[model samples]
Each structure stands twice: as structure tokens, then as C-alpha cells.
Target: MTLEETAILGCALQWPDESLPFLTEAGIRADTFSHEIPSAIFTAIATAWLAKAPGGFVGIATALGDRLDALGGAATLQTAIEGAAQPVTLPHYAEIVKEGHSKRRLALALKAAYKQLTTEPTGTVLAAIEAEISSIAAGRDKARIQSTREIVMSVLGNLNSRTDGSKMAGLSTGIVRLDEETGGIRKGGYWVIAGPTKGGKSALVRYIVRAVALDQAKPVLVFGLEMSSDDTVEAMLATEGKVSASRMRDGTMHEMDFPKLQAAANNLALAPIFFRDDVYDLAGIRSYVRQVKAIQPDLAVVVVDYLQLTEGAGSADRREQEIAIVSKALRRMAKDENLAVIALAQLNDDGELRECRAIGMDATVQVTIEMCEDEPGARLLRLRQRQGKTGVVVPVVFNGETFEWHPLAHEPEPASGKSFNRKRK
Candidate 1:
């Protein structure tokens, strides 16, 4: 093993509390070491550290357990400590390890890319290069294990830091009760919005987009699988301008409508939002998000305008199974990137999420939209949050003219012949 690798490993084996944190923060994983022997030693040290194993070479031995002989054993560990560098310059050694890993990765990638030059298509060769560079630039961090105590303490700290009137933990969902009950759409959350045909699925998402975009000025991204790019913009224009969508569609707006449209466009331009109406397949969606995240890391939320439209891998599976694969992928992406994703789903005639029950199974929060029984122009959003509450119906009225939603005072009571759609006081 290299002297730098031994020093780093020795530092970790000796002063795990001090050096392990740095090693983890510096993105040092077991594979970062060039040789398998050092890599095995490093892996054991990390396992012991996270499990709160005892200090010194004994701790490393304890972690390795029965498999100690498979590695260089306790005697080789002695060599590591005998050649140990002081913990003060651990950061420098860690940097060397990272640099060496990058160089190796780059050289290997270039060799493979060169081979592809003759055999593969131009696009395939460029893809290989781009993937490698992106990987190198990302410097993927191996996760540091967090104890339950640490997690609860973090929750406590977050709650304590909130201002007196801070109701939500993430972006506002535009409904007061929904925000208060579920703490809004959160980072690393996967939300499923399901509804029947013409049941305000698009309208609800548009309301959230508007709330996040123009209302809060947060960066938002929308993948309009079912909606055209021009249609998405046109709908936004009508909604923001408070112009009748039908009139806008029919091109029958009065002369004064031009100024309103212009003003709405001006207002929308203030919000940093992107639309990928052409992205349909899963690879395209993931690639676009990765590219955007590389440039704009603080991208708040991603909206998939109806999930059932997008094509995914595992295409040979049964239709329902394929959809389940897609749903799992969407959920995985949100968790991997620490991103919030809202995927709209179509409901069957029986008002259940169509094709894949996994869509609801994987969602952190699932909301189903149903039209109000008595109020023709309004819809009720029934929320079933995995970690929060269930059996909560949020009444919302749709203003078709401006393409907006207003919260109603209470849930509808159709049995009593009272369907209230009045705005909440």
C-alpha cells in the first residue's frame, strides 16, 4: 500500500472520532484506496467507527471479526500504525487519495472513450466521455451513517430554529390546511397526485406551480409529458393574466387583454422556471435534471405533468408492472438527489390509481382529487400522507376564468344538502 493510504488508514484506526469525520466529509470511501488490502482495512475501520466499536487496533480487529485473516491480519495493522502520520495533516493525505482516484478514473475513461471512437457511433462515444466527466466532477459522497439520536436531535434543532409563524418546512402547497397538516412539499419527498378525467389534476398542479413560481419566486421545473410546450406556456399566461383560458384559446380576447397578457409575462419572467415538454422517457428525465442540478443546485421542485405518459425501461414487462417500475424509479430519483417530485396520475373509473398500486405505495404523500358532489365548479383534495394524517379532505374551488384554485371554508356535506365553496375567512 502507498504511504499516504497507510497514513490515512492509520489516522482513522487510531483516532476514529477525529479522523473518521474528516475522511467521510472528504468523500473517502473504501474503494478510494488503490489496492484491495488497504481498501479492506479502510472498510473495516469505517464499519467499526459507525458501530461505536472500541478504539485502537483492537477495534479494527473486532470489526473484521472472523475475516481478519482474509485481510493482512492484526500484524499488518501494526505496520499501518507504525508508519502513521499525525492527525493534523490528515486532510492533506485525504486530498491526495481523492486526486489519485480522479486521475485513475479519468485515464480509464479516456482509454474506453478512445476505443469507442472506432467501434461506436459518435453520440455513443460522446455519452461515455460526458458520463465520466460528470462522475468525476460530482465527487459522489459515501453517506455517513446517522444514529437515531442524531436524527431526532436534528428534527429538534429544525423545529427550534423555526420562526414563531413558520408553518411549513418546505415549499408552500398553496392550500392553507394542506400546508399546515403536511408541512408542504418537502425535499426528498415523492408526491403522487391522482384524479379522474377532468377532475382538476392539471389545475391543482398548476396552482402549486403558480404558488411556487410567481408567488414564492422559487426555481421550479416541469416535465410536460402530456402537455405541449406552447400549451404549457399558454396556460400559464392565461392563469397569471387572469384572462379567460377559453377566450385565450379561441383568440377572442378584447384589445385590453394584450396589456394584461404582457404584464403577466413580465411577472412570470421574474421566476426562474424551466419546462421540458419534450422529455418523455426516464433516461431523458434523469439526464435533464442532472444537467440542471449541475448548473442550478438549488432547484426547488420538479413536476411531471401526468406520470402515466412517460416511457421507462423494463418495457417488456406487463403494462402494470412497467408502470410500477417507473413509479419506483421516480421515487428513487427523489431520494437520491434530495429532490421533491410531484407526478400526476390518472385514476380508473372506480377512482383508484390506475395500472400500478405501487404509485401510491412509493409516494410519501398521495393526494386524490374528486369533484365536489354538489359544487360543479369545485373539487375536493383528499390527502393520504404516509407520515402525517389521513381522512382529511381539502375543499377547493376552481376559477376557470383565471385558472386558479381557492380554498373553501370546510369540507362539503352533500348529505345535509349543503355544499359550501365559499373562500375561507
Candidate 2:
């Protein structure tokens, strides 16, 4: 161990209370210690601090009486104390220890990255590097507590700037009626829309992204893990170009449809949407978002085509555990990044979502979309919002050619099973 590291550890052991704040604030984890004995000692001290018990070496030794000799006993403690620097400079010394530890970690990580570069694609290697750098930056910039008065003043400033009395504080989702009901999408919000097979989940998500990115001019990151990027682009083109998706897929588009398709393609080519279909892991998504955000700091939204497909780090054998982990990470990302997240989920007939119950638990707004039996081109969006109202169903009509959903032209009789079309007034 370096002289500075030894001194910091020694200070932490002898004057635990006096040095606790400095060590903690230095963002030093037990692994940061160079030697096994000091690492173990630091771990014990951290445990004592959390438990609000005596944090001195004697107290730590007593707590780990059985393992004291393994941690080098009194001799090790004496050596650390003898080498210790001034207690007043403990924080400064702790920072040096932390910097050394970080360099060691970075070296190890870079070694692995070098191996990955030979085996993995360039994008994959870059993403891994981005993730590592972001993790380090986050540790350095961890948020501190804020005063309630200061928080209130900041919130008031936000409220005062908005001319609309609308409570929504984020980008609009582009659906007029849905926006009215939910007050538009809100910052740091997790929203889930669940539906059955062929329930237009992808269609709905695309429209929202198109609105936020193309029309509203906000940057968007979309993860389309279920489908290939090429297919996603084609579907979007069909929806935006007013061309029949089947015709486009079959290469049966009419001569007249060529103009519309070209127009839509040109418009979308300049959109602020960033699309990816490869990543399926939560960590990769976080890394990719951070990499993109560096260039477009104004990124306002993230959309995942479906939730069940995403995987995480740990052994998630059970479906519920997997869901919980994925949902929690996504929720944290939304809050930390302060962007709206729209995750689509599949629903079983029993009213249970596939894979996890955490989808409903973590979502700020849970919405269900199903075909409107009485209306051929319309779907019902049943809103169950935890942040606002619940049990409200907004009728929406989808123009299959345009792939857009709009408010119902007129109110319909309750449970009336009459078929209808998308004729707007």
C-alpha cells in the first residue's frame, strides 16, 4: 500500500468518528484499499459506522474477534498507526487513495476491453467503455441532500414559466385525447401500455415517438428489441407515408403511392429519433442512452418496444424476479436521467402481464389498449394512473393507412356493438 493509503486507513481506524465523514465523503469503497488487511479493516469500520456503533479499532476488533488474527491483529494496527500522517489531512489523503484505486480499476477494465475489442464489434467495445466511464462519473457526482425551501423555490420557478395551466411537465405524447387526460408525459416518469397480440402496441409507440421527435423536435431513444431495425423503419414509413404496410412489404405499392412514400421517407430522414434494435440487456440500454445523450443533451424520451424481452445482471430464474430487477433499473434510469420512459408489455387473458407484476407496480401510469368491438378502426385506452386519475377510457381511432390514433369524432352509446370507420369531423 502507498504511504497515503496507509495513513488514511490508519486515521480511519484510530479516530473513527473524526475521520468517518472524510472517508465516507471520499467515495472510497472497501475494495479501494490496496492490502487485504486494510480492506477488511475498512469494511469493518464501514459496518460500524452504519450500525451507529463504536467505530474505533478496538470496537472493530471486538466485533471481528474471531477473525482478528486473519486481519493481522494488533501488530497490523500498530504498523498502520506508526505510518499514519496527520489526522487533519485524512480527507485529502483518502482522495489520493481513491484516485490510485480508480487507476488500478481502470487498468483492469481496459485490459478486458482490449480483449473484447478483438472479439466484439467496435460498437460493443465503445458501449462498454462508455458504461464504465459513466459509472465512475456518477460515483463522483452523487447527489447531496437539498433544503426543502430551495427545492420548493426551484419547483415554483418551473411552474411559473409554463403558460398553460396543464400539469404536465414533459414532452407531449402526440395523442390529443390521451395528452388531455394524463396532462402529457411527465419528466422522470415510467409508463406502461399493456395489450394482447395484434393489439397495436408497436403502432401506438411509433406514433408517440414520431410526435415527440419529428413534430415536437425533441430527441428520442428507442430500443426495438423484438423487431429488426429495418422492419421498424419500414413500418414507420408505411404509417407516416399513408402507404399500405402490406403493399410496401409485398412490393405491390402503386405508382401513386411512390410520391407519398418518398415524402414520408424524406421527412423522417431529418427526424431527431435514434433507433436501435440490438441491445437486450438493461446495462447496455443505460450505456447506449448515456453515449447518445452526450451528443444530444436535450433527449426527452426513451421507448422500449416491450418489457419482457429485457434481461439484467443477476440470476433471474423466476419471472417475477426478472421483472422486478428490470423494472427497478428502468425506473431509476428515468429518474436519474429525468426523461419519460414508455415501456410496452404483453397482457394475458387473466389480466396478468407477462413475466412480472413489477410492470404495474413500477409504472406511474398503467394503460391498456384493446380493439373497440363496436368500432372497426378505433381502440379503447383504459387509463389507470397512479399519479393522477383512474378508470377513465378514452376512445381513439387509428387510420391504418397513416398509422395514427386520434380522438373519436363523436361520443358513442355505451356498449353499442355497431361497427364504424375513422371519419373525422
Error of 1 at 34 (Å): 27
Instruction: List the RMSD of every prediction in angstroms.
Output: 20.2, 20.3
TM-score against truth, every candidate: 0.64, 0.63
For all candidates in order, the CA lDDT equals 0.78, 0.75
23-73 per-residue lDDT for model 1 (tens digits): 765777777889888888887776555434576898778767777887777
1-425 in candidate 2: lDDT tens per residue? 67887787678777766776556545666667777777777766655654356766578878778788987777776677787767788767877887777777677768888998887778877776667666665654233333466699988876875545644566777887788778777878898988877778888989888888888888888899897767877888987887888888788889999999899998987677777788999988887676455335577899988888898876888877987898888888988877888999987755567778668778888777766656678777878787777767788887876677888866443224421111110
| TM value for model 1 | 0.64
After superposition, which runs of candidate 1 have C-alpha atoms over 4 Å from their true positions?
1-138, 141-153, 161-163, 413-425
User: How many backbone overlaps does candidate 2 show?
Assistant: 0
Lowest-sum lDDT 10-residue window in model 2 = 416-425
Highest-scoring model, TM-score? 1
In model 1, the clashing pairs are: none
